[model samples]
Target: MTGTQPFVLAEQALLGALLLEPSRIDSVRPHLRPHHMYRPAHAALYRALLDRPPDPGLTMADRTMALVRDAGAHAAGITPVYAHTLMAACPRPRHALVYARMIVEAADHRLVREHAVRLGQVAAADHARDGLADTLTHHRHLHRVLDDLHRRRPDHDTATSTPAVPTPELNPEPPLPGNLDDEQALIGALILDPAPMSALSRWLTPADFADTAHATLYRCVHALVLRGEPVDSLTLAWEAQHQGAFAAGDGGLTPELVAHIATSGMPADVDYRARRVLRAYVLRTAASAAAAVGTHAGDPTLSTSRLVTAARTALTPLDDALARRHNAITATKAPFTHTPPTTTATPWCTGVATWPTTGPDPTNPTAAHGPRSGRRP
Candidate 1:
């Protein structure tokens, strides 16, 4: 099947830009993978761009010829002149990164569309067999596949040069819906009264907040609480600025936002709001764990024991969090009491010794000594 035409154009433009200016390859290479290009020739050319060594002496034409020869474009009936054709077609060489992202997005869309068609066929077959449960499972699997494809991005470092492609057995985690309202309310409550920060810190983390701005604000407040500093609007704005949290643009935290949250009608019951946030987080975590277990359940390579262990590992954090909450409630209800010392003192040191009130005699050190000190012992 033919790939999307716009993506093909984008792929050509990116490759063309790289060929025209190899110096910009390092910046664009991290975001673009060979598989991101839909056409085989384009993918091969991108691979060659990544694989080629830095050679300042080589002219652009020589480099283009080398890339074409090394990529085996001759087999695809491509030539060195095609590189110049692409360069001439490209509108702006400086927008290579933008074109690279467009390619990735287009590739993702195509993958999702293809998978959806396949999933529809499977669902139809399963429905004919009267396997409703199996059909639902396949639907969930398809959703996870699409979700992984959308969320996965290249890492900053080249620990793994290749991006992980989603498969039936080794699918990435499904995206869960976070309660943004609860997250914002909890953060606002904290800004209103920093006292709840101590309790919230035990059960919540910045990761629990769905909004990036809220997470940044929570992190700042948590740090201030740890350092015994005030967590008012001004301090939070300062901390956010210092941490570069507000530089993200658009939805980033701002001083006015901080002040508004602080002055808003925050929940009088801060603990209740905190628990709501924690509940949302726990539910989201449980759903993710269940999805992960379901995805790996059918893998033949994973032993039954390994699958069980994986499920346990995924669910253990939620279990531990609930256990801690229960323990905290139990402790709060119990009375406080001072316990006596458990250890006994030695008999030889039970009695106290008297000391002389006078200062030590410098003229005779022995004169200041006690009766048992100077003569015999």
Candidate 2:
């Protein structure tokens, strides 16, 4: 049989079990809705089972026939012979609840997969529009779907192995040539004048760079800035070598290229270029998160709780970048102030508090209903 045929057989077994022992319908009734069945005819029959009760006076065979006859009115293909076949197909009528659970599990996977598809599509659209709003919306919706699935399968076993990393779908649109330029420009600007590193470091991370070599270079620059060390071509190259950014045969970060990055770009445009880099990172991270969620949904081994946990973990990077982006924007608008000398240290150091110091801000309307969530403002 094909992969999906087992679910069809599961629907058949469930219906047969219910027909054979109508009193046991109550066992599956609360959790297994008729619409959860894979086949339309099975769904119709299940609905009929719920609507019509077996005659109190009828024998076992007669009751089965009566149930089939009633269901035939609602479902086109259900006949007495089909009913007999279903009855025979069931391995044991006592295991009806197990069959019902199987059907529900398949239904949950289908629902999660469908939602993942929509999320991937939304992520693609948001990338095209250069918007984070829809990405956040679809992510929250997928989380809700996972939450509902968890409610449906509270006793699900979560001891499955870690889900393999999914091979992400290639984004149809190649990064604009200017995207790499923006990354280079941002680094160049920082190299030319390291002062902006204070403001830019609050949001831009090395991972934001499209090119690995550039990311390595950015990391070196950021490290030097934090250390209050001089940042010129020679010092930057030394930092790259110390961090092992250079692979022997790759000819990574040639001296001429380092000088080019150090000399070019206007320092004043660091914020603009940094925003562009952050934007690219958000879109890239969203696409990756969507793919991972889709893959998690498709894994049969994953229990509902595991699926939700895996999906949330996959989204953490994207969530952090978006939060930082929002905070960066907020920080820009607020007047810059000197860092106060405090006995207590905060997780992040910007002129303003990027994250909540005590707890989630109840006053912030967009804050997630949790303990100091990294939600967008």
Name the lDDT of candidate 2. Answer: 0.71
Query: Per-residue lDDT of 307-353 in model 2, one digit per residue for the tens?
Result: 66777777777789889888889877887542322223223322222
Which candidate should be chosen as best, given TM-score against the real structure? Answer: 2
Question: Which candidate leads the pack in lDDT?
Answer: 2
Which residues of candidate 2, in runs, are more than 4 Å off? Answer: 1-4, 54-76, 158-176, 247-251, 337-377
Which parts of model 1 have CA positions greater than 4 angstroms off? 1-178, 248-251, 265-267, 327-377
- Which residue pairs show collisions in model 2? none
**What's model 2's lDDT at 48?**
82
TM-score of each: 0.41, 0.77
Query: Could you tell me the C-alpha RMSD of candidate 2 in Å?
Result: 10.5
Poorest stretch of ten by lDDT in candidate 2: 345-354
C-alpha lDDT of residue 18 in model 1: 87
What would the per-residue lDDT of candidate 1 be over residues 1-377, giving only the tens digit for each residue?
A: 46547667888888888888888898887777888778888888888889996589998878888998977752474577787887886778899998988787666555544544454455444434423344345445655654464356432323254233232333322222335666777777777666556545655666555567777888777665544445567777877776677786425678888888767737566665566555554444444444454554434333323333444455454456555555545544565332211122223212222222232331232332223232211
